[model samples]
Target: MTVQNILSIPPYHYVHVLDLNSNVQTLVLGPKSYVCKEHERFTCEPKRMISLSPTEYCVIRNPVVTENGVPVVDSDGQVRLRMGECEYRFHQDSFPLYPNEEMSGGVEVLPVVLADSALRLKARCDHVDTDGTERKAGDEWLFEGPGEQTGSSSHINCSSVRCTEISRSRLLQCFIDYLQFETRGIHIFAIKNLSIF
Candidate 1:
């Protein structure tokens, strides 16, 4: 990813600088004034008390990124959750999942909940083009939609399953169509609802 693609600002907000430490020899970047598609990951939080599909799962965790061991902010200046190497940015109000090209078909991943212990990192929109002008929204391409959770989990309730990884056949047989419905080419399915006969 180019430097331009690595830095970006969240939607509907302008970058604001909290403080700058010129005295310190080490580089301490201020809050996010901009967001980059290459450097940042964004996801909307799921509604509470909602039942989700078996094929669908969620990751509830604390943020990994820290500023002086604190949380980070998005382009909108909202606190973010860091999982692994990814920096997931969201807002206090309803956030949008963007659409994009190079998209494929798969089960829709439901929203997730972030724990309270995550650190808050700030960003600034200091990024500009060669012409020395602020970048416009249309200039970039970011994707928002139902995204799948792709990390290891410790909350599995099944005693027989030793690892998180399982074959499609095993999953289907275990759930017995209660958790999913069969699709011709798609072995794994996520359903909206199920009614027992």
Candidate 2:
């Protein structure tokens, strides 16, 4: 599907499955899933963000497909490697995973690599399959645009990005359905730990 328009979304929480490989998939994180489902980890919510600790935190360790110039390990290809998860750093921000070859349609994921940092931020809207459930794990997750770019592998060293193009519902959905939280509730600790200029 090609994206003609994108909307801005507010953050919420849900349990999302990370399609690791063709046959094997892993449940990454979701606020709703953790509280309701049985997992090996403990979680807590701080402010609008959900933090995940390692008790039940697990990385699927799988291969990935790249979109535009960014490479993400998610079903959509936009991801942030957890802080301690890899040698390369992925921020604790909301991320999307997009399929490959989507820079041609009307809708596209826009990513900006900062001039002073290695950080990358991605923002996209639904263009193809509206059926999130029916879309399956491997289906392409984007629209198309002439000059627009797909999301990034893992957003890096950056702090903020304009999420105005993404819908509030979409943003909430990603958080409720996609984040693996070490802890949920007020992210007082996370916020306190931030680097202040």
Candidate 3:
């Protein structure tokens, strides 16, 4: 049957199939592809088949070590993964697997909208400085909003901060009000405001 004809039927849309040779291919059947009872007939006995969501992505990593072409485990009993790359399987996108390549996990990117607020980030792992100084984890950073920030790779904790919106006129009035207070006969003094959004 034609791809359009197959897709028109119930429970058929798209399928990602891994062949016996470990080659991965994606068959686009329709817009809303998923795993269903009818997938086996179209898969032709693949090693594995899964349904991919357009909003989600997978991480492909090359094993750090291998024995006889199989991935080797580290002392911690976990496969050592390095040189990670992302696979964005938007409709009909195929993921070809290389030798000793494995998928780490799938991730779905969620949208966050911050209005009149800021995003606070804390490092979860120790960061090594250029001079060999280890900046311990828990180091905090801020992304001021009403703006857009893109992170390519992040392993941190995130929290939202509601900013205190003060108009320019109100800020100036507060400064003037503070100056009116007794200051040991000092007429002029420096005013410093060190508040993070």
Candidate 4:
């Protein structure tokens, strides 16, 4: 992506050497500030809980670009989760996600993980199952796709006999639908729910 396209996302971080015309850097995101390569060399952070789709949960303006890093580094050298972008000689920073902010938009992922671990982990919505076979309540699904779990592609991870990846639009719609019907409990289908967990 071009530098401008990358900066489209709100809240970023950057370097702040004002005197150095050639060695200056900046970002344009949350709590954004400047870093000086000559004096205060700061790194950039991008948005973490972003509205990937143009759904209803999104509050901030869609900048058309976004970035995030796990175990992110700060200007003071502290290891924290971070997301940001660069502006004209400035850096933007975003509100970090708690260890349990996976359901940022109220829709919980049942089969995949957005991100996890001491290092870094991120999962993107792939698709949904419209023809899901109804099952009894309290069914536990073994997640084996992203996150700390892995399974052979041939082995289906959910109750569904088939696994398929859909477009981003479908993924977003599934998340929206889930938030509407799901009651934050265990269910049998393609996925399950966790308790604020």
Candidate 5:
């Protein structure tokens, strides 16, 4: 067998890939254990594998909707999904399952839950906000809960916040912040919902 075949993931499994735009796509492996993206077939890379417990987790590809509640469609005639935000779900039984192996249940609404842990993400490329704020690559950020957070001006019910990482250190500085809160007698909930992107 070729290198691609040898390194391919098993059939019916899924691989989550993060593009430069910060969008995560769940590509399903075909029967041949290859992923087809934009007409290109390739093997799944090790870094793209997201370890999720099948019993407790599910993925939701929520559609990108406008302020008026209209769904946004891409030039390719496909509905643009908010892949970055709806990648992981804490509950698997919230939605009905498909008859077969599918990465997501298509576009549907699900109740957002306060996760046990926040998701840590790394920027792959430079991005600019609508307000002209520029974010550089290698910057780490956190996407936290459906609950309230204090002492942060940019807090939203569930949103991304810029976080700092110690240079040359693979450790996340956010965890240190949480530990500090704990030491100060602040009750920090256990973060079992943590996912790295």
Candidate 6:
């Protein structure tokens, strides 16, 4: 059966399968799935951002098809990723996966670079699929925008801000603010070794 036949399955996660020896490429949808909730990774409040650690990685979802200069939604009313000759379709319920395209789309995954790591602090809205699943934002489903530009001056600015201003108390407040809205799931910002000398 073709992809269209099997694509209807709700909440599909695409795993790229590649065999270097044979140069065979295939897309496998599967065992991994996610359902978002308001109080899970984030709250319903606007402008409330999440902070990410350096080790954290995020998956992004592209809301529109941008094969053309202008973006248009796919016929299936789902997300599409065109990487070379192969085009991948995803159910609207899919949380986040990086789009392998050269141009910038309306939606994007986070930590565009180490420089915009601060952008992780920006809060985003949760996605509700047609089936009524609430999709929370995380490294997988983060929507990163054109944040701090990369260059010499930006590097200096980011470094200065990190070194001079960020404090444990401030971080705690940020985490507390985030927690106020979360009703279920573990707190994303749990301070393990926080202490005073």
Highest-scoring model, TM-score: 3
- Scored against the true structure, residue 94 in model 6 reaches a CA lDDT of 33
TM-score of 4: 0.20
Candidate 6 least-lDDT 10 residues: 152-161
| lDDT, each prediction | 0.30, 0.29, 0.43, 0.29, 0.39, 0.31
Task: Encode model 2's per-residue lDDT on 119-187: one tens digit a residue.
Answer: 222223222322332322222222222222223333222233232344444532221222221222322
Off by over 4 Å in 6: 1-13, 16-28, 32-73, 76-157, 161-197
What order do candidates take by TM-score, descending?
3, 5, 4, 6, 1, 2
lDDT of 3 by residue, 18-120 (tens): 3323333334333443443323333422223234454444445553455785656555444444555433233244433433455666544433437777676
Cα lDDT tens digits for candidate 1, 1-197: 12232234433332222222221111112233434333243221211222235444333334334589455555554455443322223222322122111112223353332332211111132345343544432222111223322222211111111123455555322343223322224444555443323
lDDT of 6 by residue, 41-145 (tens): 211111112222433322233333566634444554333554333222222333323223222233323234333233222213355534464645431212223
- Residue ranges of candidate 1 with Cα displaced over 4 Å: 5-57, 60-62, 65-154, 157-197
Writing each residue's lDDT as its tens digit, candidate 5 over 84-182 gives 443444423223211122346433233233555454444455766344655565444454555432211122233444334455535542333332122
Q: Each model's TM-score?
A: 0.18, 0.16, 0.34, 0.20, 0.24, 0.18
Candidate that would win on lDDT: 3
Tens-digit lDDT string for candidate 4 (1-197): 11221222334322212223433333233444333333433333344433322112221211212246344434643333322311111122323333212232342222334332111112222322233534233222334333423321122333321234465545322222132232236443433443221
Give candidate 4 misplaced runs (Cα > 4 Å): 1-33, 37-39, 42-49, 52-77, 80-156, 159-197
Candidate 3: where is the Cα deviation over 4 Å?
1-80, 83-106, 128-136, 147-154, 167-197
| Candidate 4 lDDT score relative to the true structure | 0.29
Q: How big is the positional error of residue 153 in model 5, measured in Å on the Cα after superposition?
A: 16
